[model samples]
Target: MKRFLSGFLIGTAATVAAAASVVLTVKKQVIDPIDEQQVAHDEKRKRAMRKSAAR
Candidate 1:
């Protein structure tokens, strides 16, 4: 019984670690780029607005 409990705990910890790794990987590979693109787009829009206002 003790061995089984230990195994269960270890498995749960591993699963949690794996889930966290996946989330971080996705954020780094996918979400971060999208956010960077959004920031760039916002900057471009602001520049265009300033140019139009100056005109």
Candidate 2:
């Protein structure tokens, strides 16, 4: 019983740690400012090209 409990606790801890790491990574991607700026610049450039083509 003791061995089973120990293994269960270790597995639970590892699973929690992995989940936390994944959450942190997702949060960082969602909150990153540089990515937002790059996306906006790309969109603006695309719009400019489309306008020039229409002329």
Estimated TM-score for each candidate:
0.94, 0.55
- Per-residue lDDT over 1-55 for candidate 1, one digit per residue giving the tens place of the 0 to 100 score: 9999999999999999999999999999999999999999999999999999999
Cα TM-score of candidate 1 = 0.94
Model 2, 1-55: lDDT tens per residue? Answer: 9999999999999999999999989878776767888999999999999999999
Q: Which ten residues in a row have the lowest lDDT in candidate 2?
A: 26-35
* Lowest summed lDDT window (length 10), candidate 1: 46-55
